[model samples]
Target chain A: MTPAIAVRGLVKRYGRRTVVDNVDLTVMPGRVCGFLGPNGSGKTTTLRLICGLLTPDGGSGTCLGEDLIAGRAAIKRQTGYMTQKFGLYEDLSIRENLEFAGDVHGIADLRARVDAALDRLGLAARQHQLAGALSGGWKQRLALAACVLHAPRLLLLDEPTAGVDPKARRDFWDEIHALAATGITVLVSTHYMDEAERCHEIAYIAYGKLLARGSAAEVIAASGLVAWVATGEGADRLAIRLRDAPGVTAAAAFGASLHVCGPDQAALAAAIAPLRGAPGIVWQEAPATLEDVFIHLMRQVPDNAGQG
Target chain B: MRGTLRRMRAIIRKEVLQLRRDRLTFAMMFGLPIMQLVMFGYAIDNDPKALPTALLAADHGTMPRAIVAALGNTGYFAISHSVTSEAEADALLQRGEVQFVVTIPADFTRRVIRHERAQIAVEADATDPTTTGNALAAVEPAVARALARELTGPLAGLAPRAGPVEVVLHRRYNPEGSTRDNVVPGLLAVILTMTMVMMTALAVTREYERGTMENLLAMPIRPIEVMLGKIAPYIAIGSVQVAVVLVAAKLLFDVPMIGSLALLSAATLLFITVNLAIGFTFSTVARNQLQAMQMSFFFLMPSILLSGFAFPFRGMPGWAQLVGEALPATHFLRVVRAVMLKGAGLADIAAELAALLLLLGLVGALALARYRVTLD
Candidate 1:
């Protein structure tokens, strides 16, 4: 099957600073690819380039098999882009917003499609309510409904579940997976590790560079990272002390246990040697997690922020 | 009290910093006053001078020449067109090219010598009464002195207290010189300029500020489609406004509709479209709604003051008239007044009609040029 998105050397520069610098991305059909990155890491910019909302400074690409630059209008017709912020008109009712989306795409049987979308989202009873008056989760759901109203072949969601509650986030993910199961390609940018784990594949970017790209297991194994967990009365308190250790890349407390990971196994072990024999303390070797691999990957790249 | 002062100072400092960052608002704060000052002080004149007058000299004798020279000496009537026939003079007056037409009848010198109460027809275009009021007053005195100078020797006794030469001043189109007739029609132009330009100016800027512009642009819609969609509703609103004002002018103010209603409607639609295009152009240039409002105000200030809606168009200085000539409101005001007050036909107001169309094209082009299809 042809890839839904195939872009190479994707570069976008805002004046002196390059926001998306020589990065490439490809996503096959019917896959949920999570886009992971630090704040202001050009994730939104990259998504906009793929959706033909922004022209790349020095790159060529195809989105939904249409030329990114020359066939932007055609690309826009087949792709659904949900901005980081709620992009639907708040002054309009839920039904009106959905109908407007349908109108823009020239969807046939718009009323019936809108009715089905409202019913599927459980927003039928409140379809006349103003979009602005809805709760954050409901507003986000309405936005998602509007995005897919045209039955697009590809969906690009930028941090769609950023401010929602845990239950709503879970439901949103279930909905996303349901859409993916229908053979629609999805490229969703998110910061939550749990959300990233839910994707079929993940791509991590930091400071305008794509650092890691693979499945959860493949990425963790390829990081060459070794992790050690310590659980005791005060094992969590050692996080601050091990954080600045020379060989330890990331040290954090998960509940009452301390998890530490680093690229070099012996160096990481030496960093925890003094506390190994502490009273009632237990040490166990463990496989590195996706978060650990991402933390390790983030450390290797120098921050290029504020130089813009 | 001391803590309150410190908190107030901090708030003031923050406000000052934010104000400095908004460069458009900062510039407008200073630019608006300076522009108003320069326009009012240098360009505006209530008692206009050098009003253009056309002279139809049927008798090219000494008396007619003397009267023409004296009218020129008054510094009010400038004989810019010297026509040979009455029809040519009437055409000049109807087109608003000349403010007054002076007709010297045949055998005027013979009648003056015989003391036959020689009458010179002075027809003034009084659609804008204020513009012609002072010029008309100056005509009788100027002609009296000119005839006095000519009534030497045998014609000396022909000059009497009432003056031997009768100045029959006909205030055409507006015999009563009603200000309502002038102002009511002009209100249509002013109201349309204020509302149409301002409403469309906020259209795109509101979308931008609300963050909906990205979604709208991400869709499959074209830029022209967006512009037309935004402008079409405002055109309907403008038509309703025109209807309301026209009814009020007819019923309350008793302003006559002497010309074709169809013609007025066509011209009003064109004028509304022009203003809407201008407002759309402002929306493209402005970054936010506040800046859009300021831009609309900046455009509207000169439109109301310099367009002869509030003041006299011919009374302004040459440079000010040039500025007014470029504004759509100026041409629309002329069209409305000519259509309603003077019963002007299409051929009579053809120049103003063409001017409005040209303004529409230029502003439409500018709006389309500024509209960006992508965020870049």
Candidate 2:
């Protein structure tokens, strides 16, 4: 079957600086594709280009099987975009805002639709409260409700869970999964690894370049990261020293223990040879984590520290 | 189209809800008219009265006594003091104690009895041009009446030997010698322009700043439809203001209305729409509420000063009057004052209406063009 959203070698630039440098992405229907990247990694820009909000400097693509450049209006009509900001009327109540969103999208039976959205989001109790007076969690729920009220085929959420509590975040992801189960395609960009793991597939981008794209297990296994734990009187110092040692790629401290990583097993062993003694220092090999693989990937990529 | 209507209704409803919540804005929207009406009506008057003058009657004859009594009877002037010498009268004027000084020369009774050339020296403070003109005009009737009374006396004062005494007062239009009349009419322009434009500019811009505009723009509504929906309510409020100001003009200021109320109301609605369009354009360009207010004020200052509202359009130099004419408020004031005061008909005000309509069309089009339906 044709992919629900597909873009080929999209290139966009601001002035002379290229953001979203030549990248290809495709999202199958009924799947959550998490876009993971550091700040200024062009995730938001890519989303905008795909949604027809901005014209790419160069490339060709189709969104929902329509030529993106020529069919922007159609794509906009069927696409729900949630900006990072809370883009709802603060002075208006949740019910009023939802009603407005429904009316704007030309939804028939707006009152019923708004009521359904509020009920589905579990926000019926606070529907009469002003959006401005809502807490961060409630505001997040309201923003989500407004975005999904149109029942778009694709949902483009930009960092929707930022600054929200963990409970609220979990509840939000549950709602997103329910939407995905209904055959809706979701492309969400987030900085949190837990959220990324919740998606069916993850695409890691760094410095406007796509570094990796795969399922969680595939990405972790493909990273070739070897891990070891060190216990000692000064394990933190040992880890710091082992960072510059040959074959030691990453080093970090974790609660009275030190976790050291490297891509080559033998190199990691040889690198830890010096820490075998030194009085109370203990070194043992351990299982590598997804965070370690991502850190290793981030270390390999050249810095884009000042791109923003 | 149905979707657009739905969205328009949503925006209007939301705006009304917000307006109801913001009591200060509601108060200003309704209360300002009544306050300004009462204030300006009570403060303004056109009929001149109680002008200060000094009498220097060295003649001590029937003619000077008749003149003093006639001038005082006109109720336009009161002899605050009597001066023996021209120097004393000049001192009183220099000190700002008197506006006019009438001097009857020491010709004694012999000149009038001899029927020879007798002259009265009238020294006036010509500093304030408007007041000076009214004072001179007021003294004219008194001088004329006194001469007429003397000539018709039993002694039959010689009318043939008497020469006309010329009183030179400065300035013509609104010669009540009070700035209240001039300032009050101009105040209407200032108050309306600032309040209307600032209020409207803030209306849309607040939505943008508060993030509600994005929601509105996302709707299927056309940009022009949004502009119309926003401006219609202001036009209603503006119409009520017109009626209030007219009633105040008639009842308190005795400012007669000479033109059609219908034409005045029509012009006022056009003016409101034009101003509202300007404000809408500002909202489109401004980034925040503060910026919107600043931009509105910046635009209003020029329209208020350059518009012939505060100053006489003819008195301003050519380039300045050209600037004044460029503002819709200037033309509106001219049309309003003419229709309301001069009773000018449609034929008399057609050009002004055309200019105002042209401005409204241009501004409304520009506002629509400046509006964005989607984020870039």
Please tell me which predicted candidate would have the highest DockQ against the true structure: 2
Off by over 4 Å in 2: A231-234, A237-249, A262-272, A278-281, A286-290, A293-308, B44-48, B51-128, B151-192, B215-221, B250-255
Q: Give Cα-based local distance difference scores for all models.
A: 0.86, 0.79
TM-score of chain A of each: 0.99, 0.93
Q: Write candidate 1's Cα lDDT for B1-376 as tens digits.
A: 3423332333233224334554774564345333433343345545577999999888999889999999999888898999998889989999999998999999898888876878899999999777777788888889989988888897777775674787798988877666667776877887788777877888779889989999988988777777876777668767877886788677766778999999999999999999999999999999999999999999989999999998878999999999999999999999999999888999999999999999999999999999999898
- Model 2 over residues B1-376: C-alpha lDDT tens digits? 6766776776677677777777998889768877866665565444456778898888887778988888788776789999898788889999999888888888845676686767776677887676566556667668777777787756564654445885587654444444454545455565677777877899988877776665454444567667767766677666666666666666766665567878877877878878888889898899898999999988887786788765567888899888777788898888877776567899999999899999888987888888876555
Model 2: how far residue B177 lies from native, Å: 11
lDDT at B272 for candidate 2? 80
Query: Which portions of model 1 miss their true places by more than 4 Å?
Result: B1-160
